[model samples]
Target: MFRTVTRVELSELDMPRADLAEALKCCLKKVRKGHYIIKSNCPNSHVDTIRHLLREPGITFPTFRGDIRDDAEKLRMSIATRRDSLLPEDAFSHMSAALLHGLDPVEVGTERVEVTRPAYSRAYSDLLFYARDLAEDDVDHTLGYPVTTLDRTLADIALDHPLEVSVPLISEGLRERHINRESLLPRLAPGRRGRKRALLALELASELHESGAEAYCAVKFHRHGITGMTPQVTAYSSTGAFIGRNDFRHEKALVVVEVHGVGKYYMHPDGPNAAARQNHQRNMNLVNAGFKVFNLTFGDLFRPKIFEQIKWAITQALEHENH
Candidate 1:
């Protein structure tokens, strides 16, 4: 999340203290809200002075305050600052639109504000222009800033990035019901520069994926020629009792792969120890029901050695079944 600071425009300043005003004028960095700047680099004396002023009554700050670590929020602030500079017909597109629409960009950076213009394409220090005309249906302003529609944004990103980078966003759009697969297909039609990769991404995309991590894991599985896995599969006991829904299931090998963050157990409402106990019980149930469960963390998915082990495990299971 990116931090937002309360700003009083330099032109609107009515300072009773000359020293404070002088310090602010000298050290304040320019942001859309005015001369409000982060205090990270300011001298301790200046920071103290600014802190005192901020404490004064009737000096309310905007909702966004302090350090911002959220990428989406940071991009939003970037868009807000640059909104005034955009032409009336221009709208934020591609990755910028993706972020605005609440879709993750995966491996892409959010530093540059991508805008689509009716005229020429160009790149600037902190801005990128996609030269293309947008239909009335392709633009939206519900976010308080002009941006490409959800379908348009996904298509644009799909057309510009690789499968690994684009599939997660597409899957998220589908998962969230913001855009359907059919509406986005046309934009990635044949003869487009990245149509092949884009189409593959669309084919691999699944709304059943609960998170971008699962969608990405699907892509990785495909790339590794492991195509038998299905997302969000339910396991059942021989007597038809319900077992939990697993993240990915390979029926032929009787393997269930679960992708999750380490914090899941720790952050559960029931507490980490209880969560771990529940997880262990579930794993035992799946095993007893003739399923091999593999718990994978986000970090595990990225390690080649881990994938190699998974492949070997699945292969062994398949061979055993054959015998």
Candidate 2:
């Protein structure tokens, strides 16, 4: 039993105070007496009343403001149903690193947020990428929220993601053993992946070590010109305890080559002294077994005098063998 008491002025009325009751009445009358058109603009001001009066089943709530919250249901419904516009973060979840580097070849279209959540965490979203049980260091920020780091990303790609995407970044970072090893090594896993990569890196690092001793050792070895004997030699104690794997041991040639790189191991107060004593003990054991051992430093290897010392030692070994 609703009726309009009197027509109210719709002129110069501010939103907060403008005749709410009368406006509601007039809107109702229009719906019943004339073709009711809910104005497309200023939807929120009129939406509540329209919904209350109409109460139509299955009709959607009218669209209003442009914000995601304002039309969240409709937008979500449209996205699920339309199939044209994908969420931004979903479209580009794994490519954030490449995108940050300005290196992504393909174009991504949406602006939705991407998130990486730990498996143990209960938190989730419709568009989030759930990363199962990520390590503490792997958690980092992408578009303000946490994502994986470059190393983690590469490792993920190395293990599970495609090789075409992973190889370029991994090879570039690891080609020079000294360049980014500290940053990259932590991300490698322990089994086959670790051992295989470690061996390759070790070979390069070992070469780099020798290059520091004498630049020509690498060049000579690679050139294959100065070859008397190669580096695989075995050392034995009278009781056979297996002291260490030697770099080079000449059979019946008393010369044992120890190559010194530029940077030594991390030094404490007695670090160098302790290292020297250990080397002396090891050399003593070798010498006691009737072998002459020679150590080479970076400077000594490069020096002509040291080269003569080596050659002289070789000649003596042959002379001793002859005796």
Candidate 3:
């Protein structure tokens, strides 16, 4: 926990903006009207500001000290803003380019820092720089200076990463109403390096995928001539009772492609998990009704060989269903 020393005054100057201004300009962040917080790396700055702000009336200047490890969770937003203060320019755009645009935070991820137009410092491991001018609609006061628009963010990620790797973020952004093609397609027209990548990503983009693994497997199935797969499909038993929903299903082939994450997401050995139990019962019912189930994971989708296995499963199921 970060240790803090508090002092209340009567001046009503609140955050003592001028004193903090003279302190570390980087760490001064507005939490709300008449209030501010600090996350300065420079202890002297904090000490000096606290001392100065304490001299004023109606002010509550709290000086925080010690390690911030335990308080990191509560300080997440502060840490993000502090990180933002480190970049050269257009810091927020870098964030949106790689991570924002309503990307699935649980699966794909979010970025800490994005260096803009980073041609010189190409050696840093933790830093990612994008070399491009901000397109129209890329920045806003609410989004902060130099953050990519939803469309531009997807285009940028698509440009930097492989289609399979980047699809989840973009697809989720699309699915979640975070972005669309009208704004994104225009931005793709200007860049040569990412034109093809962005185009392909957009072409393959679907609101159906909840994870990158699902998107990757969907595309591979398409390439493998298993075009009948419908994503996020629901299935029922032969008696017309509700069973469960499948990730990707082909009704004509009587095949269901299951993206395997429920084991980690819902399964619990020590406690009763309704989702897990229901999924198990539903799968058994589907099997009894003659539906062939195909399973894959995030890792399995990475291997090229999984496509052939999927092809075999789909082909065999189609033949059996027709017979």
Best prediction by TM-score: 1
Candidate 3 Cα deviation (angstroms), residue 234: 2.5
The lDDT, on a scale of 0 to 1, for candidate 2 is 0.42
RMSD of each: 5.2, 23.8, 9.7
lDDT agreement of model 3 with the native: 0.58
Candidate 2 clashing pairs, residues 3+ apart or interchain? 88-110, 88-112, 140-147
Identify the superior model by lDDT, candidate 2 or candidate 3: 3
TM-score: the better of candidates 1 and 2:
1
Give all TM-scores, in the order shown. Answer: 0.79, 0.32, 0.62
lDDT of candidate 3 over 1-323, digit per residue (tens): 12222223213435464665554365454542333454444455444535554444443332443422223223333324333344444444433334433344323333234545434434243344555565445654453345566666666667766665467667777777656777777767764676887787787778887665687776676566667788888888778887777888885788888887645344555444665676677779889877877667656765668777767777887777678
Q: Which digits, one per residue and each the tens of the lDDT, describe model 1 over residues 1-64?
A: 2222444433234333554565557644345435244423445454554454455444422233
Off by over 4 Å in 2: 1-226, 232-234, 265-270
Single out the weakest 10-residue window by summed lDDT for candidate 1. 60-69
lDDT per residue as tens, model 2, 1-323? 01111122222223233434544544422322212232222234533433343344433333344432233323223222212223223221233433332222111222222334443223223233534556666655543334466555545444443333344344443433333555655555566344454433323333222222332332223333223433535677778865544555655576666665424433435576676787678778888877667666645534566555666777778888899
